[model samples]
Target chain A: MNIKELHRQYKKRLAKEKRWIRFYQLLLLIGFFVLWETASSNRWIDPLIFSSPSRIFRLLMDMISDGTIFIHINYTLFETVLGFILGTLIGTILAAILWWFPTLSKILDPYLVVLNSMPKVALGPILIVALGPGMTSIITMGAIISVIISTIVIYTSFRNVDANYLKVLQTFNATKWQMFKEAILPASFPTIISTLKVNVGLSWVGVIVGEFLVSSQGLGYLIIYGFQVFNFNLVLMSLLIIAVFATLMYQLVEMLEKRLIKNE
Target chain B: MGFLIVENVSHTYFSKDAATEALQDISLTVEEGEFISFIGPSGCGKTTLLSIIAGLIRPTAGNVYIENQKVYGNKDLSIGYMLQQDYLFPWKTIEENITLGLRLLKQDVDRGIASKLLKDVGLPAVEKKYPRELSGGMRQRVALARTLAVDPKILLLDEPFSALDYQSKLKLEDLVFKMLKQYNKTAILVTHDIGEAIAMSDRIILFSPRPGRIHEIFEISEDIRRLTPFQARSHAGYSPLFQQIWKELERLEH
Candidate 1:
């Protein structure tokens, strides 16, 4: 066959392979839900504890109709997003400062390692006392863990930027600020984006944990309330909501990474 | 007066526990619009000398001068240094990478000049492509364009073609030589290849290893000066010059 005909056949095969993969992914998702529903309806497992898909769906609908789910979602999302933004912003600024001031960075390097290793969840009650019980406390709790991680990751990336690129700038008689802008900033951008992805999950966990301690209105509060009232279904529903929202947030970060990489 | 002068320059890399001398009291003068090559073995400190000239590093004992001004550190005295690796910013497109020096200098980036330089390097169609998307040779061409964009009076090339394949190296040598000559810019290239030094340079400065000191400077025969690197390789005197430099390098090897 001619080259064009061969190329066409190759493209067809690739398309067919992609379609099969997508089909299998959808099938797997459906299969998991079907098996869960079947096992619960047949009493193969205790539905009260496991709380199958149908029961959770009904509970989700009930919450939505009462508009409670939206309020909870909005509150949780606000805390998480605020924490993510503040954490990343503070972290990046601090990392840049550390890079600019090497002596200070050296002094604080071991301290930062100690802070990073400390369990942030153990500090929940202290955060509540420091910031008081509210959105501010929840957001602050989330930001604390994320800030330290982002700072360390970004600072390490900054220090490891290619020396050759910096030499290129130096040859042009570039100022220190110019070197940071031209070489250091652009080179460290990928690491920064990856940090954003990591901060999404970290911020979510921090908010949820904070909410469990002091929140009156959020998914975390609902889970704790459900456990107290012995409404296992409600607890399962809250968990499902948190999982979906977290995945969506992570996917959003992934999308942003794709766009940024494409532009680069 | 010479356009560029190196006076008793020496560099010793000092660490916490050791001091390693890379270049001895190397002194040389390069005329305006002349192409010179520092040819030596691996540890000769030829690259160290180029970095010192480019003001990236200060020598231990002496200084370099351009137009009677002493090179203490980075000044606005337009000197371009090209490395063995392209060192093109991978995040940027070819056009952006080429204009980086101009951007950093707060000068206007002239698209016309960038295109012209790319055209001169025979890569007229890759302005929007990222460095990694291009071959090793194309990236180096973009790097050369970047160095030229700032309009440097002197170019320091540190084995710029060493990383390329043989065919790409030959092609790049021709284009680079012709471009330098056409621009009438002074250039100092440090290389291990004797043929490259003979074909591209007006004078070749041979150096000895371990404390890189100048051994001898050979002026190219007049007839070879008019030819491109590709044509110069086939010229009758090319083999003899290559053999002579080879013998000198072998003597230094011992």
Candidate 2:
């Protein structure tokens, strides 16, 4: 065949391969479910000790029938959203201030490192005491990890902006504020959006951990209650719900990233 | 007073690890509407000298003056600088990048001026496109238009065509020469290309490396300036002049 005909054949084969890969992905998922159901029914694994996907689905149906799962999901979603917003806002402001004030940044750098390394769960008892057994403590817990991580990530990316672009403005005698607005912020925007994507996962982790510690009504609390009462199916169901919700939140961030970097 | 004067300017770059002397006791005077090229090896502080004149750097000793005023930390003169890379802000579209200096100065951005400059540089229809969308040559044209947008009295070009392919570089060189002539702007270009220096300059200032100081100065006759760079390449004295500059550069390397 001529080059053009060969090129067409290559493209056709590549498209076929992609379809096969996607087909196998679905097949693998279905096959795992079938194997799991078979094992549970045949008693190869005791369904009581090792709950199957069907058991988890049944628990989900019961929760839906009673309308309690919605409350749990709504509570967790509200906490995560609130924490995400607060963390992003606080982190961005702190990063700007740190960038503006080098001396303050120097003084606080080591402390930030220590705080990031510390197990945030250890602060649960103190947060409960300070904010009481309420949404405030849970939101505070959720915001803690994201706040420091976002601040550091954003500040570093801000500093890493191309120095030559800054010089282009400097030669024109642009002010510090102009340099930040025109060059630094716009140049670091893609990184900021990526940080937002990461923050979705981080904020979700924070909310769930917070719920684990103090909440009476979130997915984390359901898991805790199920474990206490030896109801493995409820625990599995809550976990699956959390997974689906986290994926949805992540997809939202991905959509935002696509919009922000559209030009790129 | 000369149009622009560098009075015994010297510069030293100091760091905690080491102090490096970049330029030493350099003095020159540029007349109004003259094009001068500084030719030297890398690390010879050609860019440092241009920055000093642009008031981006303060020399260790002595001063640069434009129309009898010291140039250090001065912004009223409006020096337009173009670097090796285009340095166009990627986020901004072509027109916005071109009008950046005007924006910074808080002057009303006249779209007419930007359009005229883009036409002059042969990039007329690309105002809405981002910098990344254009070729390297096209981006440099946009950069040139950007520099001209501010209506600077003096232009500093630091190897502006060094990154381009030969054909684009030649085209840009002619375009730049024509634009500078039309605007009647005083320009100082820093380049390692001796042939380019000889083609585009009224005078070529040769410098020695490592504590760079003027090694020699050659003044090209008015006859050469009357022709375009392409036409000037075939001028009678072109080969002799090119050979002389090539020898001088080779001598400096040893």
Q: How well does candidate 1 score on lDDT at residue B129?
A: 81
Give stretches of model 2 more than 4 Å off: A1-15
Q: Give the per-residue lDDT digits (tens) of candidate 2, residues A140-165.
A: 88787688888998899888987889
Error (Å) of candidate 1 at residue A162 is 1.6
In TM-score terms, candidate 1 sits at 0.95
Minimal lDDT window, size 10, model 2 chain A: A255-264
Interface RMSD of 2: 1.0
lDDT of 1 by residue, B133-171 (tens): 888988888898999999898999999999999999999
Q: After superposing candidate 1, which stretches have Cα over 4 Å from the reference?
A: A1-9
lDDT of 2 at A200: 84
Report the C-alpha displacement of residue A149, candidate 1, in angstroms. Answer: 1.9
Q: Rounded to one decimal, what is candidate 1's iRMSD?
A: 1.9
- C-alpha DockQ of every model: 0.63, 0.72
What would the per-residue lDDT of candidate 1 be over residues A60-143, giving only the tens digit for each residue? 899889998999999999889899989998999999999999999999999999999998878999888998889889999889
